[model samples]
Target: MAMAFNSDSELFPMVNVNNAKLSIEEERRENVDEENRRKDLPINECMGEKDANLDAIIARYAETINKYNLRNLGYPTNQDFNYDKLAPLFHFHLNNAGDPFVGSSFSLNSSPFEVSVLDWFANLWNIDNSEYWGYVTTGGSEGNLHGILVGREQFPDGILYTSQESHYSIFKIARMYRMHCVKVGSLFSGEIDCVQLEASLLSHKDKPAIINLNIGTTMKGGIDDLDLVIQTLKKCGFTRDRFYIHCDGALFGIMLPFIKQALKVSFKKPIGSVTISGHKFLGCPSPCGVVITRLKYMSAISRDVGIIASRDATITGSRCGHAPIFLWYALKKRGLIGLENEVHECIMKAHYLLNLLRDAGIGAMLNEFSNIVVFERPLDDDFNRSWNLACSGNIAHVVVLQHVSVEMLDTFVHEFIEKRSIWSKDEQFKPLCIANDVGSKNCACLMHTTYHITFSFLSTFVTYPTTHSCSPPPAATSITVLRRLQPQILPPPPSSPSKDSDLTTVVLMPTLRSTTVVATVAVVAAILTLSLLGIYYLCLTLL
Candidate 1:
């Protein structure tokens, strides 16, 4: 009994498990109510309030954007171009034709819209072929894809030759078609190594190949010597049948035709096919690319891919109708003279920028044939010098703003020079040196220049701001230099009005005194006239 004295402990206390469970349930409900209260707080205050707040945010964003002078720095995805002005002429109707698509599958069998556009394009190229055929794609890349697909069909077992600097999409298309891509070396200037290309093609003489000639390379705005490439092809015994030449003139095709004519250079070599993007220099919205081919080659490619059908040559089905319409509208709006003027203006602006950079002692490069100008920092300069300076420690943190005014370019260069001076003394600082490095290191700046201009098509909508500011004040030496030199570079502000007592009295007091005197005289004359007239009326009534 003594040993079992554990009975002194009140045995087992009654456990209320249900109450604990009920308490947890109540806590959960309270938590849920708290959450609901938080959710309902904004809603209970107002119903349309969210939309109003969103609208306010959007308005502020738009205003801030307007504050920065972004004329042509950013590319635009869409544009109105006062389309509404010509809306009366535009017609929309249901298709009455039995087939969904009204246009012919083959571009040679032209529709009213296509025929007109093609004729205009052909005229720009100064080609005699009224029978030239081309179809509009999303952009140059898509155009290249279509061209490559056609090329593959035309030569089933042929290798494709393009510079190592050729656009990535070309390689992708070649791989997709299971074709061999022979990459030729690129020169420092960004042009393809014609000698190396010739050697590669000669080595592959036993196998059929297609040479992808780039009118303009993406990296340094380098243009291949078309004449040289054509000569090389001939020397290598490459013919139109055994090997085809596809020109990926995505960036320059639209402009080159006009440029050629202006320079009086002949583009008569009868290249097998050419691809161009309307969105690049021609300035359209979205992916509007044209694949131009001789009628015979077009016919051959059309028949080669019988299973896919020539109608389905494009990668996508149900192509956007707006592309053709917008392209046609743009071409019509920017006629031969207008296009020529734009090209001329762009070239002039580009040259101006190059000169500005050179004057500023910035090392920049320009192509003789095109408007693309790329510049980098000199190796000896202590400043941040290159495009990828931020990440690679090799170059300066410099950004190129495109479609810039002379004033804007001046300001950008000034600001960039000032920013670079801060890091000049720092042994660790290096500028991103190469164009590709700039692209990889600073996406924002890269976007402003290349991607926006070439691929994104946003360059039309935005412009570079007048003044670009940077954080962190420039180094003391640079600041001192800027302060000493700033007066010469920047325009002076307007002077304020003088507050001298004598001047105020002589100028403002006389004007006020004269105004008061004139008002008093006019009032007195009005009162006298009214009184005399009233008295005369009274006398007439008495008579």
Candidate 2:
């Protein structure tokens, strides 16, 4: 039977699943090649016939995997794949060596499938087939390696800039390349702090910039504002030719495109490259990713490899051919409509979990356009391991992936609330303060509880320039409350009072009795309020 690697063929498979495995008698009937016979001579002399031990070990491993998959709540991987129909592909040894755009010399390679997958991602990111060049990488880390390398090639003296919240891979790539790297601050929302970024850019104005923009951060799922970053670059005197932006959209890159209001990451923008993990939202069985960059950028890295008869531009040679097939199969099965529904469902379920936590008085937060529900870390390590929750410091997050159901969330929350009651009873185990992680409004700690009350009382009498509720800046180094409150003392108008004059600082004695006494009390309250906030903020800063 012949298999055609095309969109239609991938959509409707012709291969029979049961007939995929060949019997020993059938295998013996085929003519043996000289290389095969040579390889088999040594193996035949060393070993006997296959036994049931290997089968039993695999079965036990599968059982354990199935059990763990059910409780996989913390990771971004989608564990709902059925790729049994594609089992026939396992018979052939496949390797997609060199670039996907250039045909490989190896006949057994799955380059056609790899090209199809690359074309699909190219179209999604609004790059024409002729305009873009990419290859299916091992995972997101390789994608970063390639993208950053391209940026470095473009500007040899460029300084790498990425948020502190970005994946550990970005920093590692910088160190590997031996490029000067700058760690930018992030807001409480986990997005890159443009204010701090502007300061950094101005200081390093002599060198060109190579930025690793996070489409979605690991812990908080923060999407950096691409437009704002571009604006900041221009403001810092970095021209179009001087800067390169590589979007590391490991998880949200696929989901954000389907979202109507999401900031689209199109090639039309000034971005140099975009990369996404195939195993994340699309859910391939193994770790794989796609990185797409402009065709023009390939000139710096491309070199003809005579052996493979293709360009050696990719980060690794002999890439996983099986991974591309799996990626293509996953994408073909779930079209744009199917992907959108899954994305929305995950976000909705995240909101459901957030509500459950808040109802139970658990300090929790869910970002505006994210499926990650972050909350206080569980006291029990066994409980955390049971759910496979990813914890960072005082906070742990549940990445509401496609497999995480409403029922599962309910069960998890109920267990959490019950465990929390027991944990809270212990005097030594105080409630973890997460005001710095999630905003002051979201935090329900003893200090922030008083902090919230004081701010709420102040908001009644004082009109701030900005809203009272603001998330903490990166490192929680500054107080938003002090920055926003610019109190203007307005005296009553002589003829009549204007709306601006409503919040009066002074009035005539005849207008109200004991006006002096009232003013004195208000002044005293204001002094006490500032003193209390200062003490609390001081403690937070020291910690």
Candidate 3:
């Protein structure tokens, strides 16, 4: 059955239960044995040229990365790119010191290419060449740093507000600047909770607000509503002068413009700056990014620094000039139509992967405008390592990049099904119920399916008032008492649906560590204590 999703971005992924503890132990042993097959050479040790140790090491390293690349499905990096044509430029020392547009006395810089690349992005982001001032950054993090820094420079006492699901770089940038940072609640889809954002804005009305909105989140691929965010600011009484909005569209920035009628990122909007990575969807061979802000804001960062004989505006004095060339090449080669085709192809592949998982009796979810197919985490450690999957506690996702084709997806699905079947032994495996995380309707687990499916993330109240006798420990509250001892006792499938309907409540303990549990409970108030930090940041979902 298909895992249907609501507009709110709820995802209840189904996972197979652990049948044998011994099987896991055996797999761990095998994994340890396999680790010995690939020995790491000590870098500090001297290599004799006569033995060809250097050549052997390079060959082994190349082979390993190639194999890993074949199975790579976790990260957002688009691996379908060729830079062989630009490899000739690697011989020279091409460094864009100081500002990209500003000509340096050092003539070895490739600032012309850098400027051209910046112009390309500026045009894509709806910023005119004459009206915008920006340079090719090291990557998305640098772009974020520069964008947010400009906001801080403009409004020195501004409070940085970002969704909790934002890239770690946002918070890191906040810390680096030593500015007051406010972590806002987000929807399960990873988009910013504008309701919560407005409340946060209202609370911090005394200070200037600097909002960091995601073009697309790192984990769940959620796109924060720019229009709604702007509306939220206005409702909270922050005008154009008092607030600065910096959009971090690291992955989605380039993709969004190509997407027809997508949330338009225009200079016409009341946005301070926009940033995106060249490596992510654009497929730059090296890490590179672009940040385009109004020409007016350039004065805050740019000034004559005598040593470099140019404006010292960027985060780093010397930038990787080659990165710009690579980005330029990618933009020139793909053009607008080529990129649009790749974007459509990726979204299609993501939908196909979702179907493959669902048809195999696994619950999965794909957001309406995302290429990230989120599913239940594989219980086996070796299986995760083999695919190089990126997994959180209960969920694992496959980012369907341009290189991830139907054949590769087919092989992955087939292998996953085969391994799961062998592990389960004639359909003995019970599935984990994630009704609390995703809504009940989407949860394909035996218990969740049997129960009422009307409950939502914030409203789904599961009370453990029953002191019903079980082989368990004393009670903290009804919910935490018996479940804490062996929380994840997933029930086996009943012969009939009516067989288990007599039971009032079946506790589906979440797969969260004590630390993650603290964060999780704080997010969605399942219990009575919803008000933490004077903010009712509701639970579950991906946001």
Candidate 4:
């Protein structure tokens, strides 16, 4: 039951959800590996004479995970972590069902570690313990649920406002809570359009606003301008008490605080709450997230649960006590310096991947201060599934996490280029233009291919006058977009000039005038010395 439709829309000429699911099921059925299925393993059914062969099964599973981890780039989960030291603790079952600050009667709980983790986040977000209340949830989705629920409880009649590019969970939360949701538009970068928001806010000026601002969007890794969003709310006559902001920093939440000049997400700002994924930038063995909000809003959400002998405000009952310890270990080990270094490393690797993609004539985009690198989706489904690429419409993204290395990125790019060439040659296919998706400057499709020749950062171009006097270079009619090519690897750890000394800057021009070079030989020979005299000044304008 497969249907094929054709159109220019990104959503069209694609696999339908229902058929895709059926296709996956059929594929799995047809390609079932009997050896890998552990069909011979026997489970001990209630005192029956059967051996589970648990050891062999566990070893097989471990091997499979190790193999999968190498190619797992579609998701943002960080695979570079270890919690082997806490293996003994896994023997006991633990649950922190109630509020972390208020310890529960369950003595087996790891509430102490949980509280410490929450405090660290609160302090990180610039909130005093007395003024803040938070808890570790299952993962980012729960954190979002908790944050938005707190907002709804605080302002019961508030209308939910979120951009079209927001995580799918936001709309689900809206539906779950039965709140009137206002879907706002977004810019090409996926940031919420402040103008559209202002218009929406003005249209519904009476209802209180519960804005879910994206610290980093899902696909494009776009960070909604928090400052601009706040400004728009105020300009639209929504005052301090009239609105609430919940910063969904799922991808960049914890990472942004470390990056220089990155938009600061803090309690000091008028933001009501902030949520970040523990397994994202801050890698964890388990799925978890933290959500912190103002203490003033606690009374409306929190309540004394007689059964648990503690306040039950969190979205779930019996939260994973093990998750908090895992988070604590990661934060403790990384500290500030280690975490900062990891974030910086991921972003640099992303840049390296982007450079590789573009250099190979494949269109790609990497956001400023984001680790997610977006590119044109591959035509071959097998090639896409082999690397486990996360795709939407005509675009696909590879979230370069701490585990993603230069070697792996190189391998991925090489394979992509090779496979892409084959696919295009076979079909005589034209590369898709993603100007509407990313931007004109980043697109490499046929219509926009000439733009690449307009300006490249790798070549040095000299515009010389035939006369012996210095002449002003004639300006081109079209504007050229300038791009930088930073070093593949950054300088080695903290406080050293040795690394900086090894670096050199090279000017690359995409194209040069077709003028004669015979007259410039006198200039080319003496030009090295003469160029140095004016190179600094000339570069200012030419670059």
Candidate 5:
């Protein structure tokens, strides 16, 4: 019988397979080494000729900024935007200070000035008491990761619980620590469901549990009820010590002090630890986050893990000195009253947009607690008719719908509507004739189109033009050609006029004028075309 062939048979029968594999791996290592050598080349040597190219990239960006109407936003285009004030506060030279890899070196130590500032931040969040303690991190994600790590350290076998709409980082942190995560459903009012949370806890009663409560969720800006969550935990016989509660207050922590006063609730509470991101509402350019835990729990994990002192409690080694400094500066600059005022303004702006949508008869959903508001465009009879027309002809009509919640929505909707209006008017002016004119036959087509376009434009105009000088000027009318055919029957208006008042009377004036102008323009165009054709024919004959 012929020798049996196997899929794993080596092509290099003369050489050792293991050695061959090792040789190839060595070659790959050499290639990587070569790449590293090339990368290590000095910037000036490697990119000498590309300096102009780099400058051109920035120039092109600037040109694009000019071409598009994006000049009003206070974003910096060059490097000269007040770097002196911000640069010294950064820990960019921390590694250069001393021998970074050494054990317990004084040069590698963190700034005591930074630690004092962090202490202030902890106090600001109501974590200064003997029962509470916390330290700064690079960002909310890192802070959350540290929080979960602490949770896993305390309750090694616990399942991490959070809302379905919680930040993705929560689940990621859980996975990083090899912990099981249980997501509970959210409420209709855009909050974590207390009942579902209770059920989740009961279902996972066999395992130690850690609840990751989000103060401000990414989507819908939903806030989980901490009071209810605490109550449910108590009902399940899970005390603060038995089950850790990590409050991910990244976006909302800075605002809590202000909001708490309005709600008449103390910020100091039952949660074991809370994480905060300074960049979201704190208006910081660099990343800065803090994790606040009870003093007992903090003390338990205070042992230094390498360069970071044991008591540091942060996830990373050699923490950035600037984070705590920035946090301290932000807290001091914007005191409790200032933060409350800013949050109040944001809420007011959000409510303004909600009111505008309501006044415009546009259906929308507004979150009562937080500043976020979400709403879809109303599919009214007029909108449906226009949409149907576009769909029937296979023309991709842009959906004039949006979803937003909070004060940010007000600004977004306003800008969106303004840009949409300009584009809509531009589209209307284009004389592209559709093959099927089903919905085009309606007498109210022009009016309805104009009305919708104007409505969208008005919405945008209100929001965007508030701080900017560049406002969309009035629309200019353009002449468009239409086929001459017998007038089609028009649909009756939804709300009929009074019996005494004639609907026909008011409609005839504009209808007649429009018809006359359209006819006159068409006749003129036809005459011009015929004249040109006659002249061309005569010239051909003469030749």
Candidate 6:
């Protein structure tokens, strides 16, 4: 005879307990042993002659890199590109020595290609071709260096101001130039705190302001409000001439133009310069970027170079001519429509990852119009290293670039969930509190969980039944339920909690009783029915 269940709870249980424990420490040890296998490989000692051994070493390195690329998820680098056709150009050393606009005596330069790439960006950024002057940089850091240099040249005594969340390169540049830098605070969403910025500006009213705005922050993918920032500057009594805003777009510089309703990084606004990384979103074979500033700004720093037969306006003397071609090819091949589709796809994948994490009861957050999904940092170092997860403080982020696919994300989430189970098996091992990092609403810490439940219960005023109570379970039980949800891993406890645990004791324990519980169930059922009817009627009226 088949088993028959009268209730849904009997048919489909909420938690299927798993008592087995996985040996993750052994697995971590195995990984360390494997990593040490190549420790005794060839060093920087010069080889006497070209031999088969050298070729073998190169081949082995390539194979290793190919394997590693599969798990390269931490950084915001797009690995989905094929530049095989451009490989033939590597035969000659190509260098753009000086200003691309001015004719260089060195006929080997790819200045035409570089100019075409700059013109495309200028148009995209709403700057007239004649009004803008820029060059292909080695990377985003070089771009920032050049953009900030332009601002510094304009205002020699100007104080540099950037949010604390801005790229580390910004502060480094300030140090290199020996400029006074004011690091403003950022909001919970990782965006620049305008209030703090306003205060900083007011305090430094004596000195002219040279602001470095992040189009997309490194860790959080937070877009500092350009309009609001500009408004703040004006409100602080800074005139257009008194301030110079340099936008370090980097990963999002090439992407933002393609996104509709996104704040435009344009010269039409009061921005002095804009820089974007070619390798980040475009997936160039090598690290490269573009920096565009007003043509008038060039006059302050540029000098005629007779050796190169061109003006010396750029940061570096010998620029990679091939970088421009790689950038140009990417832009032309994708066009606007292809790039736009890719941006949307990346954002969608980010949302997919966020939903998957939240559904698994992991604390996660995704900022609006961003492809970076922030979540609680994994406790296992081996797990973090295996997936190449970028972590800061209590939070970790996965930058969903064009190369990241849904299948890859699914695998990543699966592994993360599995590893998390192992990390939380001990009754004492509690999930880290990421409330300060991602805000309480998104955080799944015990303290925040209580707040969330209380808010929800208050919103619908219908009391929960003793049997079917809505209160959060005990720490051990909640961990068990989560493990049941992801049954593939029956793992062990983590090392230790990084911070203090806020594991609260549960109050409303479930009861298998009848008297008052039955009456409470009836009221709760009626309330849910009425709430559904109200939503149905609201939808009908809107239609």
lDDT of 3 by residue, 53-153 (tens): 67666777677778878988988888888888887888998888898787887788888888888888887878788899988888899989999999999
Estimate, for each residue in 1-543, the C-alpha lDDT of model 2 and write its tens digit.
999675754544454335774444334433353433533332233246565365555565576667779889999999988999999999989998887777878988888998899899999999999999999999999999999999999999999999999999999999899999999999998999999999999999999999999999999999999999999999999999999999999999998998889889999899999999988888899999999999999999999999888888988878888999999899889887888899999999999999999898778998878998888888799899889999999999999988888999999999988888887665334568888898878887766767677767764654333322364222212121222233222232367656564233323333232334335545866787778768867865655
lDDT of 3 at 444: 63
C-alpha lDDT of residue 187 in model 2: 96
**What lDDT tens digits, residue by residue, belong to model 1 across residues 95-119?**
1111112353433322455556666
Q: Write the per-residue lDDT of candidate 6 for residues 384-424, one digit (tens) a residue.
A: 88778899999999999988888989999999888778766
Q: Rank order by lDDT, top first?
A: 2, 6, 4, 3, 1, 5
Candidate 4 local lDDT, 283-333, one digit each (tens): 788889999999899899788998889988999898888989999999999
lDDT of each: 0.56, 0.83, 0.77, 0.80, 0.55, 0.83
Question: Which of 5 and 6 is the better model by TM-score?
Answer: 6
Pull out the clashing pairs in model 3.
Answer: 187-543, 188-542, 188-543, 523-538, 523-539, 524-538, 524-539
TM-score top scorer: 2
lDDT over C-alpha atoms for residue 54 of model 3: 72
Model 3 misplaced regions, further than 4 Å? 1-52, 425-430, 435-438, 452-543
State in Å the error of residue 246, model 4: 0.4
- Prediction RMSDs, each to the true structure: 27.5, 13.7, 17.4, 12.7, 17.4, 19.7
Structure candidate 4, residue pairs in collision: 457-508, 458-508, 459-508, 459-509
Which window of 10 residues has the lowest lDDT sum in candidate 4?
477-486
Error of 1 at 208 (Å): 1.8
Worst 10 residues of 2 by lDDT: 475-484
What's each prediction's clash count?
A: 29, 0, 7, 4, 16, 0
lDDT: which is higher, 1 or 4? 4
Ranking by TM-score: 2, 6, 4, 3, 1, 5
Winner on TM-score between 2 and 6 is: 2
**Model 2 backbone overlap count:** 0
